[model samples]
Target: MTFREGCWRRRLRGEWFPGTRLTLRALASELGTSVQPVRDAIGKLTVERVLVLRPNYSVQIPNIDRELMDEIFAIRNLLEAEAARRCVSVMTDADIDDLEEAILATRRVYWVESEIPSRVTTIQGVSRILAERCGSEALCEQLINLRARTAPYYAAALARSDDGEDAEFVTFTIRIQDEFVTALRRRDEVAAAEIRKVDLYTFQHYIYRLLDVE
Candidate 1:
């Protein structure tokens, strides 16, 4: 990656706070490059929605808003569950195997002895893979957008100390995955939808509690 691209990536990873200003001159100074590269980087990130252009004619990091978070999760629940249900009827043996392997791998990557690791882009990656194979492109696209927006929260939750919540959190994930895979294998659309609803609600509750305590 170019220096400016690397910087923008780091900023997306929350190395820089939301609403951080990024002017061409300032970024050029930090990147030790000319303004052209900075402009290129800014343009790329703008397309990705990783950076937002402010009304005052400067670039700023995307800011977190509670309402937006809710809407994202709500749409995520609807589209993902529906798509997963649809996918089961058309799933090949290889698809089931891949889904199971991806979930198991994500379980290991996300939780280390019931403790969250410092960086967790892998879990998101795997989730995207699972969501991608769904029957509907529109559903997958919506899920991708929702997951991208909510990723930082998941990372934040992982970075939190396990404290006494380790067992509960791990168990929750295991239960959700079990229900999901079971419903898929059986082609039980109703069960799959219910499981997803429960999973999403439980997840929101956990995040709220964790963030509140922190």
Candidate 2:
């Protein structure tokens, strides 16, 4: 991708910042490129469900219903905790090391004043690897789709905090993920399952607050 194209995609993914409604021209100007690349990138992201195109051709970062958002995360918890638990017997030393590395990387970025999308991407990247290593292809795909369904959930949470994601939320998430890793290291299936559920519900809680359901 052109630097301009890459930057535009990054913004759409909320890598640099949370985005609202943005016109193609405005995005093009910021990227310092012509409108063509912006248009192409926008089209691509829309297909990825990363951007929603309005009737007037303006693009928006997705905003989803809070109830549905929470439900997706719950599904993710159910699918992925089982996957991780199952994968334990099959996990090699290298796989364990990689998981440890991902955990550390997540901790490093947890409190950084970076954009939420980038942070979300980092979390998901490691998770995808962990999920895929599980013996079940079907479970892996389900977890991936579940994660993707949370795109709007992440967007809404980032926006709701207004000043950006609070240190408390970040720290809580890092701690939860670490507990999950600990469970994995110990081959404690029940503990792993519980920690994963906490991560899922805590994420749901953010949306619940937004919907005033909590």
Candidate 3:
């Protein structure tokens, strides 16, 4: 990948904090590259809304707000529901097995503060698998980009260490994932799509609560 793309990848993956003030020279020095590539990277991310250029000559992560969060969920619901619907007919025994494995991995990390990222990744693995099996590359690409944009918010939500709260979140996630796998196993496209929609909105609500935005 180009240095610019690599820089964009890191930012989207939540390597940078939400309010971090980034300068071209600083990033270039940190990435062990020239300022030109870093400048190019910042320009691209600024266009993507992943980064915003300030009047003060700095780049920063976009501050998440209610409107942005709602829009993200709306798009996710449409694309992910369709992906789940398409996957029902094509999913195999091995696909179900992989999803179960992902759930199991998530279960193992229950309530671990430091492992929240892994938990989020494991939960996401199911949909990623479904998207791959669904035969729609455009839909898959949109879902992936949406996930990258929202992953940091998910990580922040999952990192909550409130008493009994993380357990509840984990239980909620495992239950929905189990239901989704069961729908896939039955080849019930309608059920799979509906369940996936509920799952996405449910998690989105949880994250919204974590952000105190809803």
| Runs off by more than 4 Å, candidate 1 | 1-49, 54-58, 110-119
Q: Rank candidates, TM-score, best first.
A: 3, 1, 2
Backbone clashes in model 2: 0
TM-score of each model, in listed order: 0.72, 0.65, 0.87
RMSD of 1: 4.2
User: What TM-score does structure 2 among the candidates reach?
Assistant: 0.65
Query: Which consecutive 10 residues in model 3 have the weakest lDDT in total?
Result: 8-17
How are the candidates ranked when ordered by lDDT, highest leading?
3, 2, 1
The numbered model that scores best in lDDT is: 3
lDDT of 1 by residue, 1-214 (tens): 7865575446424355444576778778887888887777777668866667765446876555666667667877777667667767777768878877877876665455433322445455434665777766777766765665566566566566364675677678788978888987888878876776776667766765665632
Q: What are the candidates' C-alpha RMSDs? A: 4.2, 5.0, 2.3
Q: Highest TM-score: which candidate? A: 3
